[model samples]
Target: MLSALLHVTLPLALCVLLTRCRLFDAVAVDLSYDHYAEQRVEHLPAFLAMPCNCLVNLLYIITGVYWLLRGTDNAEPEQGRYLRQVFAFMSIFYAPVQWTRLAVLQRAPAVLDQWVTLPIFAWVLVWIGFIERGAAGWRVWHAAVLELLSVLSYGLALLHERGFEVALGCHVLLAVYKGVRVQLTHGDARTLRNFMFAVLSCCGFVVLKLLDLPLARYRIFQRFTGHFWSKVCDVTQIHFSICFLTNMTSRTKKTR
Candidate 1:
C-alpha cells in the first residue's frame, strides 16, 4: 500500500502542485496567436496540453514498466517484445517534445510545435489499433493514414486560425470510436468499465480545456477551478487510457 501510494498517488499530487508553481509558469511557452497578432500573453496553468505533459507521460512509463516486469508471458514472445518497444518508443518520442516546448526552445514557432505533436497522436492511434486488432491486425499503414489525416487536420486548423480546435475534436471523436469498438468487440465487464471511465475523463478534459480560455481569465476560476480541474482531467484521461489498454491486453493474454 505504501509503495503504491508513493509511486502512484504521490506523483499525481506532485505534478498538480508543480503546475501551479510560478517557476514552471515562468518557463511556459508563449501562446499568443500568430494570426491574430495578439500581444504575447502569459501561459495558462490549464494548458496542461504539452508543456507539462511529461508529468502524465511519466505515469504511462511507470505503468508500462510494471506490465513489462510482471505481466504474464504470452505464447507469442515476439509480440510481447514488440509491444515493449512500442511503449518505450512512444515515451521517448513524447518527452522530448514536451521538454523542448516548455524549456529548450521556449520561443520556438508554433509550426514546429505542430510537427512534434503529430507523432503523439499517431502513436495513440497505433496503441488503440493494437488493443482492438491485436499484434497481427496492427499495421503501419493504418497509423500512417491516421498521421496524414492528423497533419491535414492541423494544417486546416492553422490556416483557419482556430489553433487545433478542429484537430482535437477529430482526435477525441476518433478516440471515442476506438473505445466503443473495443468494448463492443471484447464484451468484457472490466473493459467496459475502463472505457466508461476513459470516456468520462475525456469529456471532462475537453470541456475544461476549451473553457480554460474564458474561465482562466477570472481569478477565481484560474486559482480555484479552471486550471486545476483541467489538469486533473487531463491526467485522469491519460491514467485511464493506460489502465484501459493494459487491462485489455491482460484480458487478451488470459483468453489466449
Candidate 2:
C-alpha cells in the first residue's frame, strides 16, 4: 500500500510543481545556448527552454539529496565512515572543477570535454572507499566492474564523439545492477523503495534526453513536459537517498 502511494503520488506531485513553477525557462538560458551556430536560440523559444532547464537542474539537486540519504542509511558504519571521507575528498577535488564550469560556462567544448570528468573521478574515489571499508565479496566485485565501466565510458567519450551514448548505456546498466543488488540483499520495504527510486532516477535522465530530440516542433509543450518530468526524477532521488540514510543509521537489533 505504501509503495503504491509513493509510486503514484510522488511523480504526480512533481509534475504539478514543475509545470506551475516555470522551472524549465530558467535552466535553458542558464545552460548557455550561444555555442552551436546551428543550435540557434530562435528554435528554442525562450518561453519554453527556460523552464525546461530549470526543472532539470531541480531534478539534479533532488537526486543528489536522495542518494546521500539512501546511501548513508544502507551503508554499514565502517562503510559510512569511508563514504564520508571519500565525499569530502571528492568535494575538495570537485571545487576546482566547478570553478572551471563557472569560468568557462561559455566554452561549450571545454565544459563537455574537460569539466564533465570531475564527477566520474569522484565516483572512482567512492569505489575505492567502499573497498577500503570492507565492501567485499560480490559487492566489491560489482563495484570494481562499475568502476571499470565508468572509466571506460569516460575514455570512450573522450576518444569518440559518441561518448554520451556509451555513458548513458553504462548508467542504465549500473542503475539496474545496483537496484537488483539492494533488493536482493536487503529484502526489506526500504529495499523496494530504493528500487523504485532508482527506476525513477533513470527515467528522469531518459526523459531529459528524449526532450532534447529534434522531433518537437512546438517548444512550449516540449518544455513544459520536460520540466515537469525532470522534477519528478529529482524528488524520487531525494526520497531514495533519505531512505538509504535511514536504513543505515537504524539497523534491526540483533537477536540474542
Candidate 3:
C-alpha cells in the first residue's frame, strides 16, 4: 500500500498526466451511453441515469470497506496488512472511476476506467510474490516499478484499438499463473477453493463485459446486461482475492 499516498498516487498521477497529454488520445473507449444495454433515465441525475450501472458501483465500495475494516491478528506482519489495505483502497477508488465513466461518457474517465484496471490485476501477482517469498521477496521499489510499469503499460492502447485488451489479457494470465503456482505450493483446500473462485470470477468479469452487446439479445441480459453482471463478478473477484490472500497471509504468520 505504501499507505497508497505516495507509492500508489505516483503511478496513478503519472497515468493521469500522461493520458492528459494526448498520449492516450487514440485509446479505444466507448464514450457513448448506448455502449451499455441499460436504458437511461434522462430526467435523473447524470450519475444515476443508468440505474443498474451506477448503483452496482456501491458493491465495490462496500466490499472495500468490509476488507479495510477486517480484523487482523496482532502477530501479522506489516507486509500482510499492506497487501490487504492496498487492495481494499483499490476497490474503493476504482468504483468511482467506472461511475464517472458512465456518468460523463467522457474520454478521460473512460480512459481511466481502462488504464487503472491493469494494475489491479498486476497487484495480484505482487501479492502472490509476498505470499511465496515473504516481505523481503517484494521490496518497495519492486512494487513501485511493477505498478509504474503496469500503469505505463497502457501506452499499448495507443498502438492499436485492442491494445488495452491485450495488456489486460497478459495481466490476467500472469496473475492466474502466479495464483495457481502459489496455491499449489502453499495453500490448503480452503485457499485453493478461494483461488479458484477468484479466477472464475475474474473470467466472468472479462467474458461478460466482452459480450455486453451480444448478450443483450437475451431477455435477462437486457435489463441486467453483461456489463452490469461483469461488475458484480469484479466485486466478487475482489472479495475472494481478499479471502485468499488474507488466508495465505495468516498461514504465513503461523508458520513463522
Candidate 4:
C-alpha cells in the first residue's frame, strides 16, 4: 500500500507544486503565442496545467473506487446496469494501468508502454458511446464494433513496423466519429459543446503523442516538455470525457 501510494501520489504532488509555484509561468510567457505557435513551449502549459490535470490519474482511481461501490449504492434502472458494471470493471483496470504508465514514464518510457495506454482510451471511447446514446440495440452493437476495431488496430500496429502509427490513426478517427455523433444527436447545448471539446482533446492527444519522440531531441522540449504535454493531453482527452459522461448522467437522472 505504501509503495502504491508513492507511485500514485508522488507525481501528483509534484504537479501540484509546479502548478501552485507558477514555475512554468515565466517560461510560458517567454514562449508566448504568435498566432502560428512556432515554439513548442507554447504547448507546455497543457502538460503542466494544474488541478484538472494534476488530479486526472487520481480521478481515475477515485472513479474506479466509486464504481466498485456504485453497484450497491445507486439504484438506477436495470436497463444499463450490465454496461455500468462492465464500465466498473474497466475502471478497475484503468487505475492500475495509469499508475503503471507513470512508473514506465519515470523509468523506461517506451512505445510499448505508450501502447498499453490505448486500451484504457479504447474503453473510454466505448463507454461514452454506450452512456451518451442509451444502450439500445444499435447502440450496444456500436460500442462493441468500436471496441473490436480498436483491438484490431492495435493488433495491426504490433505486427508491423509502423503498425502503431496506423493503429493510432484508426483509433483517433474512430474516437472523433463517436464524439461527433454524440454532438450531433444530443439536443442539449452544453452536452453538444462538451462532446466537441472531447473531440478536440482527442486530437490534441494524438498530436502530442506523435510529436513526443521527435521533440525529445531538442534542448528545450527535452526539459520535461514531451512528458508534460503528453500527460496534459492524456488528462484532457480522458478525464474531461469522463466528466462529461458523469455530468450528463446526473443531469439525466435529475430530469427523469
- Choose the strongest candidate by TM-score: 3
| Local distance difference test scores for all models | 0.53, 0.42, 0.86, 0.50
Best by the lDDT measure: 3
Off by over 4 Å in 3: none
Q: What would the TM-score be for candidate 3 when compared with the true structure?
A: 0.94
Q: Model 3, range 66-155, lDDT digits (tens) per residue?
A: 988888887567888988888888898888888988998888888988999999998888888888878766687777788778877888
lDDT comparison, 1 vs 3, better candidate: 3
Each model's backbone clash number? 0, 21, 0, 1
In model 4, where do residues sit more than 4 Å from their true spots? 1-116, 128-149, 213-222, 247-256
Per-prediction TM-score:
0.61, 0.51, 0.94, 0.54
Candidate 4 residue lDDT tens string, 1-256: 2332343245334433433443223221112222111233334344333222233456555655565455432534343444444544444444444444333232122332434445555755765555565534335557556655654455554356566666666666766677666556542777667766767776676676557557766787654545446556655555456555555554544444
* 1-60 per-residue lDDT for model 2 (tens digits): 233234323533443353344322222213354321113234554433343443344444
Per-residue alpha-carbon lDDT of model 1 for 93-192, expressed as tens digits? 3344444444333343334444434444454566667666676777756765765666556555435555466666667777778778776876488878
Superposed on all Cα atoms, the candidates' RMSDs to the truth, in angstroms, are 10.3, 12.6, 1.6, 12.2
Residue 101 Cα positional deviation in candidate 2, in Å, after optimal superposition: 6.3
In candidate 1, list every pair of residues with a backbone clash: none
Better of 3 and 4 by TM-score: 3
Q: Please provide the root mean square deviation of candidate 1 (C-alpha atoms, Å).
A: 10.3
